[model samples]
Target: MVIMKKMWKNNQARRSVSQLLMAVVAILLLGYLSSFVYFRLDLTADKRYTLSEPTRSLLKDLDKQVFIRVYLEGDMPIGLKRMRRSIKEMLDEMRVVAGSRLAYDFVNPSEEKDARLRQEFHNSLMEKGLKPVDVVESKQEGGTDTRRVFPGVIIHYGSKNIAVNLLSNNPVLSSEENLNQSLQALEYKLMHAISSLVADTVKKVAFVEGHGELGYLDVLDITDELARYYEVYRGFIDTQSPNLDEYAVVIVARPTGKFTEEEKFILDQYIMNGGKVLWLIDAVTVNRDSLSTGETTLALVNETNLEDMLFRYGARVNPVLFKDLQCALIPVNTAPAGEQPRFVPAPWPYYPLLAPRKDHPITRNLNFIKAEYSGTIDTVGTSQAVRKTVLLVSSRYARLVRVPSFISLRQIDEKPVQEEYNQSFQTVSLLMEGKFQSVFTHRMTGKYALPPGKTFREQSLPTAMIVVADGDLIRNEVRGRGSNPHPLPLGYDRYMQQTFGNKDFLMNAVNYLTDDAGLMPLRVRELRLLLLDRARIMESGTFWKTCNLVAPVLLVVLFGVLVNIIRKRKYGRPEKFG
Candidate 1:
């Protein structure tokens, strides 16, 4: 019996040693194989952590180191803290794909002890285009305190740097909703800034300026914004020697004068060569300056002579003014015009706050677009080859007024009947794409010939164009008078002192039209907004806390007890009566 026990102990020891050796060898093999064949699984319902194919491609192709400094650190509200966490996680994922090409750090500007030095640093950041957001916090013992936070990032690639603002401050949306929207756009915003800096060639964009369009001062803001990603040029469409095949995109912003046949032909031929155009044309005209001096202005048809061309391409800007009950406010005197002219903001139906469509990538997650004297667009053709997407639409309570009608400030005091404002979802902005048919294809093209050495084709290569019925959509407000006037930000309302999404809308439109790497699709990503139930936490707080603290200890104890019983049953039992 003693010899048998000793032999059994020796066999058990050898078995233990052999099992340990096998486990070690298996782990070593796994570690070696993992280096060559790697994969990660995102079990999240929305696949939030999975990077889009375009983003992965862009990161993999990055040749230089891209460093990012995010200034959304320090103590902030719960919502902002969540956003910061998301930013960190996103950067971590990017690093995994980009390896050494991407790096990022979180910085707190408020950590500086010296007040003057911090202020200087803040000013420098502002100069770099990082806007600050004020956070109002309730004090523990007293009233409240206000802190300024810059929720933005500066990306450095090669020798170029660009700033991207992470927060979307839309007053129309609640704080939570805005944060969710901002998170949805986080990927696109970062990728767009990086792509612009790392691009090998900067494309040229021409702002067509021949026909009394908004001049340098009027479009100064958009021009400056486009300069970050494109080479901007302003010139006339030469009627004598018509040629515009060089520009990638031609923008006709708020042209008040009509286009000549030769100029239109030049644009049509340019489109035939797979060029892009953004046309902000006013089908109906109302003199807003005239209304400033008086209470009323006559709305008339503004003829730019490009109607036939647009119809052939796929859309028509109607000669009617769109008025919506859901509109912006304008200041008007209500005290009989004599009591010191007490001005108060009132709803101006003609100045509609256009709603952006969420389905398209160009307008996804965008704020309300502010427009003045905007008209509706109608898609006019049955061409299956062309696809027309509506980017902006009026509210359900929209009313259309024909040209030759008087627009009076008295309309604000006059109550609108509910029945009269029943038109729903009138198209304000449209995007048309495909092989566009030339306007002069069926007409006399002998008079409209391209410059020598250039070819004119009736059918275009795959092309795209955006038509915004409101011309003033791209025009910025001016603060001062005459030559010294300062241009305000585009889509900024002087009365409300709020900036709308006109800039973002235009930027996305241009990017979508010119995108070659499929990056715009990243803008449509949606993340699940998971929120804790405060009421449930308050009601069952103690029960859940106790379970969390005690359950794991209980589970470990039960597991150990079960293991001991199994061991005893297997090893402590008397030898079977052999």
Candidate 2:
């Protein structure tokens, strides 16, 4: 009987041991499977997801397959590493919205050892029209050693290619904020370009000629840049017989001649018919750009009748000149190049450094717009679809001197002349938005508008942009020397190489204006920086070093000890000294 009982006990112990081993195997298998599943472990607090409506809509509605190729090398700079990491993190966030429509690959150019494969890769990228980026690395040695590294990206779908300019694939624009902004833009820009490439459904914009409007050649930079996205046309709007539907947007550039009532009626009807316009009007334009800095005092030169139409729109263009606290740097008349460079400190004449309103989209992320002989505009009677926002304003410390004046360069003008001219900020550039109730709204109640008898009707606002400050600093005043000014950069010419962020500002303007709020917001992206300043660490070196090295270990040790004590008291034993 004893032998039988021992046998039974032995059998039961063996069965229990076998079951425990099986349970361990099952747990291991379960852990392995779960580890392979998609689990995001984001270390950045800022990277925690925040869904934007526009991004989600674009991703969900994307029809074509967008294949993205991320070119990377095994070795990279630290800054570049940080940037790439940020890019990847942003890409992961994008995946949430992009779903499977956005396909990506991190290509290791070094992986393919075969000569044919390498050649094929290069040819494929080129065939897709992706720009080849040549990266050069110099070894720190007696003899400089150089290596060619290609780091870039290619976005493509159904033969349409949009190569994003990856300037210095290093961390040049590498911040989390920048990465997010770029990614947000990626789908929208690519879609817009691909749509353009596949379908030639281009929108038309015009630069008005005649009436002393800055000649088309003067704004070559603007036109050229705009050419990438618009069918840019250069012409004049005849107030007598205007073709309002000729273009989606119209540019009434610096006009010197006053419009007749008939001309004013045509413009009014155009606005009522939903015509988009960009008005660059001048008030007191002084040509004393060079001499004004000399012994010349302020001179007021009237270009021509500019205020009639603006006044009709509920704002009067100031005929009086403005000397604002916000100013720009102009080249003082210089001696011969070889002579001691003598550039006198001269205030840019009426070239008010426009302070952009942060609330608006067109002026967001803009540093400053340099304009000469610019004027201020004020709202008159309220018009429909006529919500005007201040695009640019002068500093509070500004004063206006009337026309027929000369800039007295040597007039004790160290400080601005204190004048009681409203003592409030006056707007130089104004943005008109919403469905503007046309001046012809009362007239155009019936059918399409006709001449002699006017038609007034309210119209929907086009994705439009305008700046009613008459100056060409932002315009490419200079054209190519060989031919008529082709365009300074964006199919429009600038007068000079002032590098005043004009092109960038204009592009951002177009982007913002054309951008759908549910697609992508072109407003500026801001990033808050917390610098881990080395000086602070160096000052409290010992304590910092200890905190960096031993603090985490100490925390873990304390936690583990507390856990053990709790476990012992709760389940194992009573804490008795004995």
lDDT of 2: 0.59
RMSD of 1: 3.0
- The candidate that wins on TM-score is 1
The 0-to-1 C-alpha lDDT of every candidate, in the order given, reads: 0.89, 0.59
RMSD list, candidates in order: 3.0, 6.9
Off by over 4 Å in 1: 1-39, 447-452, 533-542, 574-578
Clashing pairs in 1: none
For 67-174, candidate 2 gives per-residue lDDT tens digits of: 766765556654445545655665666666677777877766546778798778877765654545444556777555433334456666666555544422212234
Listed in order, each prediction's TM-score against the native is: 0.91, 0.71
Output the lDDT of residue 63, model 2. 77
